[model samples]
Target chain A: MESQIPRSKSQLPIPDYQSSNSATLKVDRVTKRYGSGATEVTAVQEVSLTVAAGEIVLIRGPSGSGKTTLLSMLGALLKPTEGTIRLDGTTLSELAENRLPDIRLRQFGFIFQDFNLLSALTALENVALVAALAGAKGKEARKRAAGLMTDLGLKERLNFLPEKLSGGEKQRVAIARALVNDPAIILADEPTANLDSKIGHEIMRLLRRIAKEQNRSVVIVSHDQRIKDIADRVLWLEDGQFKEMVTMATDPVCGMAVEREKAAAQLELDGVTYYFCSRGCRAEFEAERRGQVVGDRLTLQVGRP
Target chain B: MILVAFRNLFQNKIRLVISVGGVALALLLILALDAVFSGVEQQVTAYIDYSGADVFVSQEGVRNMHMASSALSASVASKVKAVSGVASVTPILYVTNVVVADEERNLAYIIGLPPNAAMGGPWRVVAGERIPSDGEAIIDAGVAEKSGIGLGDEVKILGEEFTVAGLSDGTATLINSVAFISKRDFAKLRGDPGTVSYLLVKVEPGGSPERVAARIEAQVSEVTAQTRPAFAAQERRVIKDMSTDVIAIMNLTGFLIGMAVMALTVYTATLSRRAEYGVLKALGARNGHLYRTVLAQALISVALGFGLGLAFTLLLAAIVPQLGTNLSLLISGASLVKVSLVSLVIAAFSAILPIRQIAGLDPAMVFRGK
Candidate 1:
């Protein structure tokens, strides 16, 4: 029995601005499962999505919503049990396990929440390694990595190890490493989960700029709503299903979702009402506006909500 | 890739030192034991090599000078001298006895050579005369130093006192310290002046030792003859057989210890950096690349350890002789090559567990927040 279901982006209703011909990634009704019969668990189910070049797509969901599993499938790090994933028009599901790494090396870039830099290597070496693995000569790989780091404002931190760098600096180095190979699509799983809200927003803005200016497609899976504004489109997920397409604002100082009507603290900046999840986020935001130094202690109060 | 491996290894300075130190200690044990055995073998054969005799004539079934006793009639020396290729014949008598000097008893081999024999006597005389008369003896330098007996000192051999006339260098053998005395004194001590231990034969200038030995054996029906090199080899074989089991146990222990140390250090290093390896694999590095990185680390550690072990063995070789012990240390290029090959094999084997760990890593784990 063949049931009629929307299996691809073309069969669904997508906004005109996102329906571009240059689709860099196309995931069709992908389902991923683990274990056997009675213990069988589906991590992601019947998920279809498309990301075009020069687009920033954010997948937002709570914990256990299959956002990471879906990202893993899209990156080819995990295979889908019932669907196909295409990156740059190459069907990843049909490729053998040994052959998939080559596709990953040339076509995709991954950014993790922890900024998974090789602890033994310096920032430049960490970035240059990806380029070297992608078949660039040593000198050229180093040059490319250095250029990317400089572009990302991490030029002075090139020789710093990951443990020595600040959280913001480490994430920037990770971003440079992801861009070193000029990958067609960038996949970030909770890129700002460990950063201060200000720094997280800065990283999100950098990613957005990369998508808009360099015409590279970017996909980020995160529960942090602070970064939602920068995305061209947002998909909300729940319990291994795509719940809806929704728009929400996030506290710029705390990275929490803020319902405009119920926000405890709100301020008008540049004729826009910025909402905050708590008085603490609102105070930190105001301190920055007043040209005062906001310490980490002030940021810690962001959890008061 | 190699650079990454090197960086990872050196990242923990303490771990690097401990790993290298463990391997070095194991290598030191192996090399020291081997060198001591080699030194003992060399010391046992030194007398045969330095005898200056083209051929040696022993009793009919005697193969080694140290293990078996050989006695021939002193009259056979004239008959051996008359053989076609024999230039000279020196009859000698050997007796293992304890020498008492200053109330200290030391085991010594009393080698009685003919007083006027030009060959088969101490080649290096550090003091006094080379040959000892009827009531005098030439003591090896090692024994003289150990016993505190200098020239003119009276030492009792078999309860009969004899004056030390000279000191000989490098004449000590594995079984006992050598003391040179005249054949008359040895015959008087044994109560049979007509019998001698063996005969040392020197050949004509153009004669081959093997050919001369064959000629002597054909003419002397009651004795077996061998070239000087063959006799030295026979002596070495006896010493080797005597200590082979102990040496084998020591070598096997050292090898096992070295392998264990290498495996543990490499395993620890690999396990600690498992997350980093997962990141590399997530970045598209193949399993072969990670294996090479681990093997490269082991190779570097083993190479450094081998060099340190060699240096330590050389130091032991220089110091052991000065300590007044009979233990000799011989470090040769052949032994070094053998140890290095074993170390390399150990290093390669140590990489197996670490490689297996890396192979089992799930690259997706790098994405997990923890």
Candidate 2:
């Protein structure tokens, strides 16, 4: 079989943010371990990366690949066992426990797969609550929250509760909440996992636009390949170790990366060959090409780590 | 943050109802228990409190009229009236006896009074006329209502028949109801016309009752004298000695039950919202913010529950007496404030478990999608 791994680290297409003039987040040789002795488990191992301002970095892996663990450490929600994480030139690992929350409040915004909005609050209130915790109060927080919601095309649904909003609309509100604080970096975990293809791609587009327009760094951990095109760089992990990073084509139907050498099926369209991860993906792609309306195939698997 | 906390409480309608209802029920139990005890205490001292006398002269060594027997010559009234600062003196007899009404026997405290005395008689007459002639008696309205007997009814006391001439309001105690009879009838029943139980005294204008009481004690031999308030305080002490332990046990039971209900309801509500709390922590909410949120929810429930419980107690106070129960509910401002303080303390205590959960919550759980 042809080697699926890229030949050299230089050919991986990873953005050289280390040499860039403006790096917003820097992770150096980070490792996270749980338990010890005979019951030891390493969730993440010796990973280093840098994300520059206005760049979007996507981290992809299968289940149990420590993507969530790595994301947690980057977001300052958890401490790295063996390395340092820096955000905007400040070393997060050296900060006191009490000051970490202040750092997270002012410098980082997080989006989760579950759209973790408080169900009791209206969309506007949910977005405004973050700003309120950061010391903005009353009308000021509401005004900022309203502007973000309107910018996200959710102005009409601002007063609706989370239960009253649709899945796609809820993700939009979550995105609005994350951007409400105007943080230096945005950390997202499987943000599009709960949305349909069109809606997921829409959320990905919103994140991409947020990075470019606001000049904020975004780091996403996801399994969905549809958003890979929007990323300036991509990192892959397997078995708690960094694997070869590959820039490959994505199956348009199923949103899975497809290496051309090991393609399950391929077809030429408009003089360009598209590779697929599965026969079903090829058939779905062909059906779409033949003007068939394939219903959304986004099936949510809840409680995934 | 407070608005979000309040909104979280009302998010689930059923949960809100159950939580608030639990607290309300607990508060109702506590307040109702306290009010009942207060009503009992008020009733226990009603006779002395309503007498409008300045001093009471009992036999020497007598502390309270209800607890011990005291006897003095009826002529002591004259000796007491001659003391300086004495305006008037009336001799009265008090005895506990069984009265048969409608063929049902009930215990009562029978007081013998002079025909024209201004002190030591029913203060407020709710029905019929006051005790007029010999062999006529005045019954308390509580006893009349409880025993299904009213004015114009005949009753038997000490094997002698007497007409129910009038009714009095709030003249009954937990141990015995008040029944007023003429001194002639009481003398006949006692086989001695010159003996009395105690002498009720009124001081002249410009004279202090405390001073007059002290003078009476100095001037009268083999007799004890007390101001009206001192006499009432003695009666209250006797009642407390008899029933304080039981009432205290009941009050403690009420407090514990209320605390438990409040703790459980708040715990369940907090547990259900633990995920949302984790999300808040992930969004940079401090432990203080989360603590305030939980405490706010608990306090809101407590306040609403207190209002409901007070309303329920007032309703019971209106309805329970009509249902023919001896339990009296007395709602007072002091008791209301006391119960409110208790409910707040319980609410604050109930927030402990939820606050701990939120404090130890890992913001990383949000990334884990659980």
Clash tally, candidates in order: 0, 0
Predicted model with the maximum TM-score: 2
Q: Roughly what TM-score does model 2 have, to 2 decimal places? A: 0.85
> Local error of candidate 1 at B91, Å?
2.3
- Residue B258's lDDT within candidate 1 is 88
What DockQ was computed for model 2? 0.63
Local accuracy of candidate 2 as per-residue lDDT tens digits, B196-249: 999999899888999998998898888999998899889878876887788667
TM-score of chain B, per candidate?
Answer: 0.95, 0.91
Off by over 4 Å in 1: A1-23, A247-305, B173-175, B218-222
Please provide, for model 1 over B1-43, each residue's C-alpha lDDT reduced to its tens digit, 9 standing for 90 to 100: 8878889888999988988888888999989988988898898
Please write out the lDDT profile of model 2 over residues A65-136, one tens digit for every residue: 999999888888999899999986699977888888887887888998989999889999998999999999
Pairs with steric clashes in candidate 1: none
Residue A257, candidate 2: C-alpha displacement in angstroms? 14
Q: What share of the true interface contacts does each candidate keep?
A: 0.60, 0.86
